[model samples]
Target chain A: MSLNESLDALRAKMTSEAAGAYEEVLQRLDPRLLAENALKPGDVMPNFELPNAEGKMVSSLELLSHGTLVVTFYRGSWCPYCMLTLQALDLILAPVPGQQASLVALSPETGGRARFVKDKYNLRFELLADVDNAVASMFGVLVRLPPLYRQRLLSQGIESETLHGRKGWFIPVPSTFVVARNGTVAHAEIHVDYTRRTELDTLPLVLRALRQYS
Target chain B: MDLPQIGYFIVLSRVLNFTHAARECKITQPALSRAIKRLEWELGGDLLLRERSLTQLTEFGRAMLPLLEQVQAAADVARDEARQLQTQERAPLRLGLSPWLAFPLIGTVLREVIASVRSTEFSVSVEAEPVMRERMLRGDLDVLVGLRADTLPERFNQWQLFSTGAAVFLPRDHLLAADELIHGSRLAESVLLGASEPEALPERILSQIVRRLGRRPSTPHRASNWETSLQLVRSGLGLGLGLSCWPTPPELVARGLADRLPDYEVVVETIAGRPQSRAVSTFVKLARASAWMNPANVP
Candidate 1:
């Protein structure tokens, strides 16, 4: 199945299995507020250095020095939707190096969890651990999980502190940003609905446009 | 009185692009232009020389920039103080510290500050050097305790707290663990673990490595903080660099580098010439007086 199809299937199963929990989360999380606060196209992407799955430091400015940078912020490897998105991006990442662009995925998950995700998915690109969600917060993708949602996750044996190495129940809204070599955001897609994601096909078009401009 | 206009001017000066400045200020282009025009009218001087290709600050704009920054900073402080007062509370001094500094030293510094100012509270954050410096400049943090760097803005006043030499950390079973002194080039073949933040590693250590190897040492594994870096070294992923003052973990052995690198100085820094609240001033005084601030008292 396609990434979107798999994500949609998981979302459907989740909502049906726990309708009340889904409704409570939807009621508390205002998509409009998240969208407004999110970094958008034309914004200047902030410079940051984060540790990848193998614990290597990957820097945005240094990535741009090589070429354009494609950054994605996800919730965690445990999330099925995030896994689907990552797998899809992994396949798409095959051509990025040739296009003179580097792809990196960021999550609040600990280095161990990030390593798991990279190994499980056989990802070729960098999977960075945004410790304490510092970089995610800077990108305006970080949000505290609502109490009800936190309770639901906890009941399911998913303790955030164990997974993220931090006590706060916070996660980044799934976001994809294509930053040009000049540091301007060429394309940005922030999905309040965790299951939704930017299509892999659209990424190349954005990169091509940015390359043309450069 | 026109704080928004001053804000727009500041944004404009940094970006030097009207469209970008407007977007950053979340105002329409025409609105930003009008605000700047009004500001110029109020001051009776042109602030910018707008051209098709470039926007240059006028002589008056250059003269007024510092004053405007002061006004904005003062306004921010006043608003923050007033809000604290309304809540019947004193604003906790937001402090940012470098992650690689010895953790026990941080606890001691905090204890000193708290003991000196009984009523004051502190919210401490351990961040990378660049992030901490940025937060300090943005006024989000009141003080920064970290290694001194030449790259820091001239507006910050730094008080040297302590100085320590660099040490190399290796796994217990690593071949170099038996060495009393490890040569920089000897470890060139191993994956060097380091703090992810560039500034966390002292320049002298990197320079020594480069001078010995005829190239910059490649760090294959980098951790977000000192603890993680040390953990990587313990796991045998790579060697780690740390301050000699940091307590060596039971599983890791720290050896001094053969070539003497410069000592790293930990400093307490605050914005220069900025007005400080009573709580901030008290913290600064305590920091200055702390035993840690005395080089002679350094362990």
Candidate 2:
């Protein structure tokens, strides 16, 4: 099948699943939210109390109060692309002062599984576990993997048990953002897969934007 | 380097017609036409537009264009630095080679370079074009070898190795496995078990087969590599194509080919601004020498 047709089939499958969970989860959003960039510059970030890699509770407001924030969203730690991108960020942060923008990586994986990403990449940034994608849904970036990929990963012994010590089969699309000192998002980039990334050189431009906005 | 000439070449590579490229280049068609011929002669490759509608870049033309772009960018940077090449201390070379070439070619270059020059250390990372290109742009890698990359980002360089195309693999029990060779057109009717999902080389190979055979075969299974492709064939999914001369895969026998398909050219490339370290240069020299090592006939 063509790429579009395959994606359409996958979307139809997801629509059917959403119907079953319509009352509990799907109803929380306005139907038109998907077409919009949910978070914009100058918008206050929702004060979320998510757990970090070590299972300690960390509040978004606490991180913000310390310095500027660099909030990044990833599908999960299993992705090589995400691992590489995050590693690049980890390497560049020290050189770039960027007005003291502190870095934090958020993913759907929770608890010890979240810690694994930190340990694996030796990430100095905070790793937040956005369990069930509460934060990702708020940002309008959560989506289910197509069944083919879901089944493929499962058959390869990479089920959530291997990834997050659970059996869930959902993940968020990879995303990254530069939040200004006042908690407003200064820049954002979100892609469906790992191959595409916001280049590190692009970060300097974003930092300039934040400097102007702040 | 002339900016318009570079733009002309990029468009010419795509459309393959001087008139079309000139139309796109927005110059009188002849001026644009002359620019390309000049480019071909200036560089040693016959980057030609064959038949009125069809065009292909001769191996040399493809390799040199990216390097030319690098030279262009470096020239711009040097001008900014008072047009002095020696002003900037040469950056340590970061060479990127495909995993395949690193084993055979990169090792030899490393020893020669180390033996020759103890001062300069070449940092090398072995990865595929897709991954290596990403890192190369990030300034993490300086050069890459093997597999002609598609649409390298701005500021990257490419040097072409010859083209190497895909071939099929099958298990002994399968009917086609006993044959001396099988054409992709003939395999079109059969359920072809792919060794990988619908990604780069497989997609290109399968698309070519379907075009040649006039229909798409059912892809019952996909494996990530040659070994798995062989196993999937053995499992009765479909035939496979072993891309390399690696080991004989488990539970399958490779069939000989009477004829072969078109070859896909691979290349070595370096990111702009990163000069080759002594080691990387040595490696590139060795890789060019050994480009024909994979005969494309081994099972």
Candidate 3:
């Protein structure tokens, strides 16, 4: 199934209360941030080096140097939509002919969770520990979860210390950026309603244009 | 030196490119990256400063360069010496010390252990508690020193080492220095300098300080490590809380905290039920008998 279809299926399964809890978390964000675009085309993507699942430091510039870079910022492993997006990217993200592209996902979750999700999916790309959503905040995708919603999640057995290495209640807006060789953002997508995600099929076309940009 | 990380970093220091460095070392780029990351995690600072267009050694990296190179050279000499003697070359003992532990005890113990044990070598990593714990679980470390017995998992066999009271350092002329013990209220009034790089001061201590002061302490000048904290304090910036040990400087006075913070009952820990090699046992025995463990020496 397509990633959107799978996401819709997961959304269909959640009860009203669970769905409302997710919405309440997003509701805490500034209204303007939800309405605005982020990291527009031609803007220089900030440099970052974060530890991957194996605790390796993955650099944005190092990835970009290889060719186009596809960076996905997800909420955490607990979100099924993020999991589906990761699987789709791993399975369907074929490079355009004569193009070299590297994919990486970022989450504020700790290294252990990153490793768990990466191993479970058998993903090809690296899952980096953003560590307190510092990199996500830099990209303007970070949102602090409302304390009530945070408590709701904790009550459901998803403890903060286990997942995030601390009591950090912040999460990214679930973003995607296609970065070109020179570190310019070629395409940016920020989903306030995180159920919405980048279409994996469209990523190759963006990469094709990025290949031409360089 | 972590030989592989030392080798990878030495190559990268020359080439300054991940692809080139990995290629020269005949390893994947990610492996090289992980080695450097692990090395940085163990050392408690970033060895390389990676800006958008620039990659170079940081001040900490530069400071560590010659020392790491000397270790690499010494290892080379040891490797050849083992070959000439027709003896089996044993891997160096990978020892990890908690950043909160006093360093003097370990130094004396290691000195005696090396003198007695034939061909004994050591690669020590001194990092913050969580990092040390993670490394220990990953088998990156064989023996860990200075873990609280209560804090460790049941999988580790912990033995009592020594107990020490916590203290803070201030310039001798500071008004707070007049008291042998500094209270939380007086400390809250001044800017607090602390180590934040490898890891922040333990949450346990920070939370107690917060409770005692009834607010977060303002840190106008935070330090990356104790050395920088001393430098900042020496410049009349702020006082420092001891993470590991009291500063050796006579200009600074070390006052025990008069607040409700608990004493540390540090223990030596190793993987439970695992067969301890002769060298590890010898090292542990030497540690137990060390003069630093004497009751009078603590503090």
Highest TM-score model number: 3
All models: lDDT? 0.71, 0.57, 0.66
lDDT of 3 by residue, A105-182 (tens): 988775256777877888878888775455565565655455566767777787655455334355677778888888
Candidate 3 residues B1-299, lDDT tens each? 13556778888888878888999999998988887886665455688987766679989788767545534542343333323234434535678876555566567667655554456678888777667777878777878886474456657755454556666777889999899788888888888775574344433455578887899677666664456667778888877766435445778888888885876656666775454443454455445333233323321
**Error of model 2, residue A26, in angstroms:** 80
Pick the winner on TM-score between candidates 1 and 2. 1
Quote the B-chain TM-score, candidate 2.
0.56
Q: Which wins on TM-score, candidate 1 or candidate 3? A: 3
Task: Report the candidate with higher lDDT, 1 versus 2.
Answer: 1
- Candidate 1 on B49-165: residue-level lDDT in tens? 999979989998987786566445534543443333334345368888788886564565466545533456778898887788888888888888888786778798665655688
Model 2, B1-299: lDDT tens per residue?
13455567877777777777787778998787666665454333466646766677777667655544443342333233221122333435577655433134346545554543344467766554687788877768766765664566777555454444465666657777667677665676788765343444555567767777677888877766554566666677787654434345566766533445556656767665564443444344334333233322211
**Highest-lDDT candidate:** 1
Compute DockQ for each candidate against the true complex.
Answer: 0.01, 0.01, 0.01
Classify candidate 3 by CAPRI docking class: incorrect
Question: Where does model 1 exceed 4 Å of error?
Answer: A15-17, A95-97, A198-200, B1-299
lDDT of 1 at B272: 68
Q: Which ten residues in a row have the lowest lDDT in candidate 1 chain B?
A: B290-299
Give the winner by lDDT: 2 or 3. Answer: 3
